[model samples]
Target: MEIKEHYSLKEHHTFKIPVQARYFAEARTADEILELSRHPAFRSQEKLVLGSGSNVFFTKNFEGLVIKIAIPGIEITKRQDGYAIIRAGAGVNWQELVDWSLQQNFAGLENLSMIPGTVGASPIQNIGAYGIELKDVCEGLEAMDLESGEIREFTAEECRFGYRNSIFKNELRGRYAILAVSLKVSDLSAPGVTYRPTASYGDLKTKLEAMDPKTLSPRLVSETVSEIRRTKLPNSTLLGNAGSFFKNPVLAEERAKQLIKEHPQVPWFKDSQGIKISAGWLIEQCGWKGKRVGNTGCYEKQALVIVNYGAATAKEILAFAYNVQSSVRETFGIELAPEVNII
Candidate 1:
């Protein structure tokens, strides 16, 4: 592992925010990560672990050791009870895993297609879409504790997943660097055996049916979900963005009823806690949708996405987000929390 000084972060992160890291290194193996953990700079300086850097925003340059997880591999480790266990290296692109699972006739993970990040980030974010989340198929994970430099394992229950959240995002945040992820998917090797896919969420069912395929499969679901995302969200390559900027705020039962009574037209659905209000619809109600300030704006198609239209400074983008949050709070008395981790 070669540690570099003053590395530009504009390309590392999807936001394309022009910033630099004081120190940077890429680890492609478990041993390399252990070695770096013992390095003098790692022991002395602050550290930030990155995986594709898709769900983060930086207000200023990170003056710390940025360890980019680049480890790569994917394989079906075992199969039993009609389920196949697929293990993927942390740095493997999330979309590629979904595609691989489908190609190998393993069922599950179709609804999560097009999510921009790596397997290492899946558990950290508990990424979800179209009625499915990473927690649904995740069997376990392995990570190297930065402080101990010892490899440890965690089961699905230990992850404590909850709607784009996990223990990794909370109590264990930054405590360890993920090395690999294991997923349990249905085995479809037998003839006449088909796995029931997730297609009931949003317009997924309708879109999938419109395709009019001979039968439903993981590949079909993946393609339909990918198509929907391509239409609703902007491509980070064409336009710098981190998908949804804010999460749908969940309110208590009584509070949700009150809000529904006041603004009955606003979109919402039942959440695990109570009612989940749509952040995009709320921003639109506040007249921030499609509104632009300098080089940043809400994407014209989806208000949930905050796009940096070439050359926007990190502070400018942050200020624009603050303005949106303020408007939502002022109008609906609802506090909109950002989903992206701001550093």
Candidate 2:
């Protein structure tokens, strides 16, 4: 619990934006977090509970304490008839967890491979890709109340998981520090049992078409998804980006019908809300793809991603994103909301 004053956050965030935190500290255990919370500086200051800092942006210097969650470990806590409950520490790398599960013959979490950030941030963001979501495997979670220092547990239903949303990101935002997550992963080696694999989303169908379905496993699916993601998204460490800067907007059925009539080429998929339009497609239609504005620009391969060319400030990125947003709105009459959490 060594708290430092005026810590540089350039290396902490995926965007690599240069910003300073008034105070910064790392906690590897629940007791350490409680101790830091009791400190005079933390008691009176605003605090940000951070993981690997992959899903956040710094619009300016953080004015108060930034507590980086570093708690660690992964262990099987319970076993059912055909599946097991695994508890992972908040600090565990998300992709590492997926790889470990595959090695252990777990059938879930393969489609979520290569996602950036720590386990602690997964539930909050409801992180998803290739037709699979965290909520599908999550059993429960443990978190510490920031003010009371009391640890609490929540079931998946209690978390209110939504598309890229959860109670942790809304009602309980800034209120709790996640300690661990409990996931129910299938035991693929279980006798007379086989868990269905997710391989129909995006290009996965084409990728898996030549493979034997009987031989399909979590490891294979994980590898396939990893390759797909690598081809589409740039490495954040090298290019300085948080993937998919904007959320795909969902519109009512009537609104979607209107747009489809206006632009016959528009792509969409059916959802509970209505129709989910492709944010990337919309941005590309606005002529922002492969486009650069000073130090900030849209990724050439993926229009939804905003990249920092070199030493780009937070303001520059924000302005560039706003311009894209305005263009999309003006052209399509749909407002795009940012997926990146701007600090």
Candidate 3:
């Protein structure tokens, strides 16, 4: 719980954006978080909760306290009726939890592999990918109200999850800090193979049949997912990135139909509300793939990912993102919002 001033945030975030935190502290336990809430300095200023810092872009130096969550632990509790409830600390790495779930023979998080960030941040954004979302497996979560230092539990419904959005990013915004999350996983293999990549591997039955039914293995699923992710996303170690830069824009049915007439090759998927068009496809069609301005560029293989080739500033990257957004909007008349949080 050592508080440091003028801390470098380059290593903290996946984008490798060079920014400084005016004040920073690592909370190893819930008590430390509670204590900090009562501190006069923290109370007077704004606070930022940082996990692995994967889903955030630091545009400039933070003027307030940056609480880096370092709490750790994963406990499997209450196994009954072929399901097990697992509680994980907020600081636990998201991918590690997915790996752990597979190791314990629990099925549910296999589809969301290789996503960057921490367990606590999952519920905040209701992170989703490849036809699966955090809310689908999340049972509940405990968070500390930063103002009152009181712990509160939120059920799945209360979280109000919707396409990379949750209560934490909306109504609850900066009021609370997530402490831990409890998830329900089942022994029965309920594989989600509807996504194109997963389905291309094989049908659900074929993939499951390959595994040993008598003895379940989470490792196999993790490995498969890891391999798939590696093939698609740029490795953060080799190239600086935060996966997808913007969310796919959802269009009204009539507008989607009009666009379909114009671009016959455009790919789309139907959600409950409307049709979601592929942002990557839109960017690629706009000729942004492999386009670079200084050290920042759009990935050649995946147009959705904005990469830092070498020395790139946060402003430069953002400028490139805005250019992409402008192009997409001009082409489709739809505004694309960034998925990464900019601060």
Candidate 4:
């Protein structure tokens, strides 16, 4: 629970934004978090629980206590029938967890491989990729109530998972810090067993067919997803940016049909809520792909991603995003919402 003052947050976030936190500390356990919450320095101030900082954008210096959650460990606690329940400390790197699961012959999470951030943060945004989401594999989670200093457990239903949304990001936002997460993974003989006879998603299916059978295992799906992502999305470590800047706006079926009538080539898919349109396609259609504005720009390979070319400020990034949103609104009549957490 060592706390520092005027800590630089430039290296904490994926965007590499040059900002400062009035106070900063890393909590390695739930006890440490409780101790920090009671400290005089944090008791009367606002607090931010941060993970890998992969999904956040700081628009200005935070005038609060920034608690970086670094709790650690991974354990297989129970096995039943054909599934194993694994528990991981909130600080576990998400990508590392996926890789480790594969090495142990665990399936289900292969589709979510290559995604960024920490295990604790996965449920907050209901992080997903390919055709799978965190909620699909989550069994339960443990968290500490910041105000009460008491730990609580939440079942998957309690999380109220939605499309890139959850109670942690809405009803319970800023109220608790995720301490650990329990996931159910298949103890299968191979990685892609559940996804056979063919991959579920179209792009993945195409890639699998193109690969040699010897390489077409559960690990292959993860490897292929990683390869596709590497070619499409910029690595935040090499280029400063958060992946997928905007949510694919979902509209009522009728509205989606109306838009499709105007632009017959528009791509969309049906979801429980409504029809989800392709945000990247909209941005690209507006002609911002590979376009640069000062130090920031939209990634040419994937227009849904906004990048920092050199030292772009939060304001610059916001302005560039605003222009894209306005263009999409005027052209498609749908408001684009940010996927990244703006602070």
lDDT (C-alpha, whole model) for all candidates: 0.89, 0.91, 0.84, 0.90
lDDT of 4 by residue, 1-343 (tens): 5788999998898998899999999999999999988887678899999998999999999999999999999999987677889999999999889998988888888888889999999999999887788998999999999999999999999999999999998989999999999999888753334434236665776888777766566688888888888889998888899889999999999999999899898878787899989999999999999999999999989999999987999999999999999999998778999999999
Among residues 3 or more apart in sequence or in different chains, the pairs in candidate 4 whose N, CA or C atoms overlap within 3 Å are 192-218
Flag clash pairs in model 2.
none
Candidate no. 3 TM-score: 0.91
Name the best candidate (by lDDT): 2
lDDT of 2 by residue, 1-343 (tens): 5788899998998999999999999999999989888887679899999998889999999999999999999999987788989999999999889988988888889999999999999999899998888999999999999999999999999999988889988889899999999999898777866968877676887898778988787888888998989899999888999999998999999999999999888878787667989999999999999999999999999999999987899999999999999999999889998888888
Q: State which candidate, 2 or 3, has the greater lDDT.
A: 2
- Model 1 bad stretches (over 4 Å): 209-214
With a 3 Å backbone cut-off (N, CA, C), the pairs that clash in candidate 3 are 102-218
Candidate 3 error regions (>4 Å): 188-219
TM-score of each: 0.97, 0.98, 0.91, 0.96
Ranking by lDDT: 2, 4, 1, 3
Report the lDDT tens digits of candidate 3 across residue range 207-283. Answer: 64676664434455656666767777898878888888998888999999999899999878787779988889999
Error of 3 at 5 (Å): 0.4
Error of 2 at 10 (Å): 0.9
Lowest lDDT 10-residue stretch of candidate 2: 192-201
CA lDDT for candidate 2: 0.91
